[model samples]
Target: MAAVKGCQFSASLSGSCYVMRPRLHRFSVKVPFFDGPLRSRLVSLCCHNPNPDSFIVDQTVPLSKNPTHLPDDCPQASASSPSSAIDFLTLCHRLKTTKRKGWINHGIKGPESIADHMYRMALMALIAGDLPGVNRERCIKIAIVHDIAEAIVGDITPSDGVPKAEKSRLEQAALNEMCEILGGGIRAEELKELWEEYENNSSLEANLVKDFDKVEMILQALEYETEHGKVLDEFYLSTAGKIQTEIGKSWAAEIHARRSSRLKNKLN
Candidate 1:
């Protein structure tokens, strides 16, 4: 059996090799499975198998002589394109945190937007949660929108002594508003859950993201001080020391010392 007209399956399964061995012209045809040189094989087959009775093919109809047609609807109908793109920019626009571009005016680089932070925290959680009993993907998703309420309430950076009840009221109102923000789609509901999960920090995933949230802010504060001056934010240090996990405590110490040194250099 040999392939004919780029139909390798046909050749191997039933037909014979159609190539003249010397004539090697490149030909291509779009078939689901079979592939080979079609024009070269066909011409060779026709030339060599000149006898009409030998090579068993329906010679009355030439495969190459068919005309292709576009349906009438093809010209008039619109093409279906993908839905809107969800890049960092669009995510930023949706988040109120980045509404003030001045917040990112500093030299800190990782997450230029709140969405960027969520996206990366999710990534970090995925990468870090190799420990037993942790659902990495769920944790990643939990991180992606943990601060969605912040998108509405605005960042309450610990310095603002807004009473706990007041902040809770504002943040809860914002959270409730988010239920309707995207019209209660699965995505919006999932984001709302992320906020709840983070706030509760009951599950291992939530706890991991909680750590990441603190870590991200500390990193941002360090970045801000680097650009501005020694100026370590007092709020960050106070919260950092209270973190129970030694993993977090160690990270705080490292950042605190690092920022303190930066502050010293600036003071000079």
Candidate 2:
């Protein structure tokens, strides 16, 4: 056996044979007993013990023609290939171009796009104070994905004359299409789950993100009112008493106080 070290061996037993090649760190055994056109199979054996007498087979890996090649079905290998990633990002360009219909309807010049709204909501989630039973990171993720479907649906608003159920259906279908565009791997599945969670208000993070959505809207409204010198009373009225979380209520109150002070200053 010592003389056979670092050498190949071929032996026939019961009409079957194996070829063994020994190496320093690993070795491979080729067996040719299969009953198909595939005449030989390679089994890789990892060498753990330094001493040959105490050699132990640590792992056995079956290899195809190329030893380092991964199968086509490997998840990590196929997840978000470059082409698919580019395609998905190209589809998302609409989010950056499509302005929020609410702002556009108000005749505001150069309104924020759907991506701008979601980005501010994400920032709101990021800067929010810690709350018990709330996952801040998940809140950020939820905020980012909350309006992602608008990339396809183009930010459908109540004034669009579409029913609530119909709007939801359109958004859901758009999200599914977006996921498919991303090639449907772990990340795609996660995006779908987060979007659904926000849509259904299924968790504390979802609740907090929902509040951030309203808070972001009202905050934007206040900024628009100050910038455009137009009192957006309807925006404030719609969000009044609708904030769910304590943080959201406090933020909304502060915005309202600031708006009131601005109005008084204008009067004087």
Candidate 3:
């Protein structure tokens, strides 16, 4: 649409674009999206208010004089604003209903949701004790958010044939979108940092969370095997040598021992 005179258009982080018109000569609308003579004209109208709180949006001025067409809720840019935080929370609700595709595709009946998987991983983090240099709180946070991106991108397993780089890119984009809902504040940055750390598998907490992830998978596999009388040895094969923490390794050993004893007893 063509630009309107005495009005400026800008893109909002909420994925919508809108136009604002000055309500009074005392305040100026900063339209970062415009260019050329129009940009200079709008710049001249922008008020240099020392107090940020004084800046107000004139929502009545629509992008193309069509007020009804703009985004329903005009969200504030402040990180601490309730609108942004609420938007983020609303996005997280999807994870609770989205099932983990890996288990479903493997023919595991009544597979768990993504939230269910993360819940068990978080519990694993909570009960984990006495790691010499590890921070258990960090582990819990990492475990909770590790699969958060899957809420947006869904669970992409190795069997999906997506390249590792491509999968990472997709998940990262989804994570960024999710964080954007939180207004890209300190909390958002921390979430990104922990998620990246888990992705890299380089830190102690990350390593512990990674092992916890595999441990959760194998434990679930064992449960399915016993409950359904189906052999899920492939899950064991996948995690055989990948667990990183001593605690994880020990848990894996116990899980394996129990499975072996059960099979041996059946044979006898």
lDDT of each: 0.54, 0.74, 0.75
Order of candidate numbers by TM-score, starting with the best: 2, 3, 1
* TM-scores vs. true structure, each candidate: 0.53, 0.72, 0.69
In Å, residue 127's CA in model 1 sits off its true spot by: 3.1
Across 18-118, the per-residue lDDT of candidate 3 in tens digits comes to 34434344554333333343221111133333333333454433333322243333222224468888888888888998888878887877888999999
lDDT score, residue 24, model 3?
41
Query: Looking at candidate 3, what is the lDDT of residue 206?
Result: 93
Report the C-alpha lDDT of model 1 over 1-268, residue by residue, as the tens digit. Answer: 3354433323321222222221333442222222353221222333233233333332322223321111112211122222322332243366633632324343344435666667767766766727678788887778766766766666665457788778877887887775554444334445566677777677877876777777766776777666655354653855744565444566667877887787677679
RMSD of 3: 12.4
Backbone clashes in model 2, listed as residue pairs: none
